[model samples]
Target: MTVALWCILIAILLPYVCTWVAKISGGFRLKDNHDPRDFLDSLEGFGRRAHAAQLNSFEVIPAFAAAVIVAHLAGNAELVTINVLAVLFITSRLLYIICYLADWATLRSLVWFVGIGLIVSFFVVSV
Candidate 1:
């Protein structure tokens, strides 16, 4: 249960972390003339990657959240299974963020698949 809670916490904070990375990456300004799209477009390199990561983070949340909640509620999984998988998923997501920021494309994609795999496994256990 605690592991599930921690994973929930991670999910909640992940977006803010991504947003912070995007903002701090570089090339953003407070110019009045720029619209949202232009402001986004002005970002380059790290900022651009961070922005993409931010968007990607949003994309994964629904399925992951559903998997965790449904599986946990179904009560088929042992505590150890839940805890280990939660740790693995969270760790993969953390690494994915780092890899994205570092522009490690290959590693980023791999970790993303790991995260997805973890989520799907969660669902599988529930069913």
Candidate 2:
């Protein structure tokens, strides 16, 4: 599989990693709550941001995955272009998470835009 495909796999796991961070942030042995909202409400600060990161990940994933699939179907993708965009998207997301945790609102917002732009680039490159 291409590194881009592996990045997609990693992307699938990233939100769960964020969720885990949120769960463990409180320094308590709290089991996963049956209601996700309740779980989110219980967190504060970094944990809250981590939960937001997980939520943000979910929000972008469908578009990102769809773009990749559509790109593949379009059959004109330059692998290098796709791979570079995919990596940039992943990097943006990771940085977004870090910025969120650190409460860097300006940086986090910029990274979020970068991620979205990268996802759009996936579609553009496929054309």
Candidate 3:
């Protein structure tokens, strides 16, 4: 597979990896159901942030994959740039999750924005 495809695969899997980390750290179970308020208290305040990252990651990744594929097929000049941005998005997500778990609210939000910016930039440039 090409490097771009590899990056896409990593982007696709990062959330699941984060979920595994959360589970191993005794944060939350994949199948567990609990009140959001209660879960927030239970996580010592990291629950919402981590949950947001997971949810957002899921939403973003499929779009990234589709955009990359379309760009590739169209021979769009932005493929390389999109791939690079996708890598940044994935790395920022990892930092985002760690910051969320660590309760670094401001930095966590900043990292989340970076990831979002990369996604938006990719779409804008690819089109």
Candidate 3 CA-lDDT value: 0.67
TM-score each candidate: 0.86, 0.90, 0.70
Model 1 misplaced regions, further than 4 Å:
27-38
Could you give me the TM-score of model 2 versus the true structure? 0.90
Residues 1-127, candidate 1: write the lDDT tens digits.
4687678778768967877777766644577235755665668889888878878888888887787788789898876787778788888888998999999999999999999999989877766
Candidates sorted by TM-score, best first: 2, 1, 3
Q: Per-residue lDDT of 1-127 in model 3, one digit per residue for the tens?
A: 6556787888788777655554445455545545533543355344445655566677778876776676566665465675677677668878977887788889988887787777667557755
Better-scoring candidate (lDDT), 1 or 3: 1
Each model's number of backbone clashes?
A: 0, 0, 0
The prediction achieving the highest TM-score against the true structure is 2
In candidate 1, list every pair of residues with a backbone clash: none
Model 2, span 14-95: residue lDDT tens: 9998988888885545454556678677889999989988998888888887777777678799887777887888898899
Off by over 4 Å in 2: 30-37
User: lDDT of each structure?
Assistant: 0.80, 0.83, 0.67
Ordered from best to worst lDDT, the candidate numbers read 2, 1, 3
